[model samples]
Target: MDARLAPFATTPRLVVKIGSSLLVEGGAIRQTWLASVVADIAACRADGQQVVVVSSGAIALGARRLKLGKGGRGSLDDAQAAAAVGQIALARAWAELFAGHGIEAAQILLTLGDLEDRRRYLNVAATLDRLLALGAVPILNENDSVATQEIRFGDNDRLAARSGQAAGAGAVILLSDIDGLYTANPCEPGATLIPTVARIDDVAHMADGRSASGLGTGGMAAKIAAARIAVQAGMPLAIVDGRRDHPLTAFAKTGHGTVFTAESCTSARKAWLAGRLTVAGRLTIDAGAAAALATGKSLLAAGVVSVDGDFARGDAVEIAHAGSVIARGLTAYDAPDARAIAGARSDAQAAILGYAPRAAMVHRDQLVMV
Candidate 1:
């Protein structure tokens, strides 16, 4: 193990996600625990490291405060109601904690749309950049009160991974109830902790049918998925126990956690594009277009051989050649418009479509080189 690569030993931009199980105890927010976490954030900032926090526990806090049932899982409506009530309390607690240390904290609630849409995605990134530039800590959380099943971050694990990509973070630390990943259930005989993981896929095989403790929603499965996202975006990740004393500080200094190594680093735009779960349409380009894409060039209408599916401007679409996808991008024009301009020279776009939105079917900036 490289000592410098340990979670606490090195100085790098980091995104730390603390789950509900860690923030709450006996169905209430643990103020002492939260204070420790805030202190750790203060320490990181003092070292000139940028930190973003993705937190879960709004619903839990709200449920407790509203006296809505006790423990166990709640209905979707119940969860949403709890989130609505608890989000304010969550922010207030975070604000107070940071204020104690003379640090400013900004609450940023985001839904899936904030990440999936190109315009919204860029806006979120810009906002975060500005916050960090001003030396303020940004507290991120999924906007569960307004998000439906169709558009949700699903869990904070995934949200933290996306936030790391958005902020160009060098590492993401997942503070969970457990210490680290194990080869088998830690309670079972012969199970052992796997301290370092080069590939997240390997850890997935070990997860099998495990589920998280009653206090949290995410299981080993979600953590592995988050690690995969971070690794692909060229951001290393560590899953460590949050219950420990000075958890974040200890991890940073000792690197004592389950570390997942990054695979390949990608730019912010490309990372956002690659992380997209769905594509709205497909653009079939010719061999020449494929060659041009491989060499990092814009996709001109003249090189497009065909268009498939109905996609509006700014929608995610796949760029293909001979039925194989070569790239993916946000479309510059809608489906019908793209079809009319396909195979036409760039200068002839206006003549063919009677007013082209853009000369290129997919501008280089909008396209992700796969």
Candidate 2:
């Protein structure tokens, strides 16, 4: 058992990344291994932890149905077709695997842009939050059917890290073909496993390229990159050997993993809002709103004096007061709606917007003081 995984027991929320090799073997799903994973998830849930799975197997599963292989699926369209067929099977497999545990599995497919765009990022995050609140496990994958080369994740490692950020996960675990990062490629003579990586640069030269499995894309290099992405957002990430059945059940007994410690301590969600987004619009609020916001309260429409620039709902916008920008957050309403409801009280919001309306122009949780 690796003592480093001690953090796993206390993680309030965790994102688990299962690569193609871990889930599929010889053109078929690894049913028994997947069942063990479900057991791990059920145990996590019992301990009151929220779980999100970022799994990769759709293309592999779809390829089998379409009789396509790496060489057979030469074109992007062909790959997309394979993914279209396999996505259904992949979702069904997860749903069925979790059925016995009395849990609902929610499928969420995304392109690279979904996380790159601030508006879509918020929408994705909200859905994840709601699904967890409803006690459902979210199964996320790259929308391979629709994703072109320009917008594809290419591998699930980085996607898992981003999904962890979006879900505000306390930690991320990458179940892999190999146990952990090695001092050198394990295939080389005298190469040894490096159990804990405190900094990526120190081990940057140790990265071995390409996956050993035909079903997976990411290799040790990719996992290193993933560790960089996750740790920057204040969460540790673990790369563990997952070839064995009931791996999670035996996690405490197996000390074969590379644990990456986070260098920063910022909340993943807040860090994204603080620096990653490009502000799309600005809202000038009254002094009252400024006062309320300083106390960590949500921005109400009644406190808004005016709206500037055009932005749709869920877009990141700056909140200003008396010509000074005080905070930035995702707006609940679009520019026109925000304008129409400016200075309007909650009682009159529906009449102003022609809908029941989402309360709070900007939620405090999403807001970051600048």
Each candidate's lDDT (Cα)? 0.83, 0.84
lDDT of 1 by residue, 98-173 (tens): 9999999999999998988878878888899899999889999998888888898778988899888777778899
Checking candidate 2 for backbone clashes, the offending pairs are 1-252, 1-253
Q: What is the TM-score of each candidate against the true structure?
A: 0.80, 0.73
* Over 4 Å off, model 2: 1-3, 71-73, 267-270, 273-370
* Residue lDDT tens for model 2, 135-244: 99999999989988888777789889888888988898999989888887788899998889888779977886688886677888888777877887777899988899
Give the CA lDDT, 0 to 100, for residue 50 in model 1. 86
TM-score of 1: 0.80
Q: Give the per-residue Cα lDDT of candidate 2 at 133.
A: 96
lDDT of 1: 0.83
Worst 10 residues of 1 by lDDT: 3-12
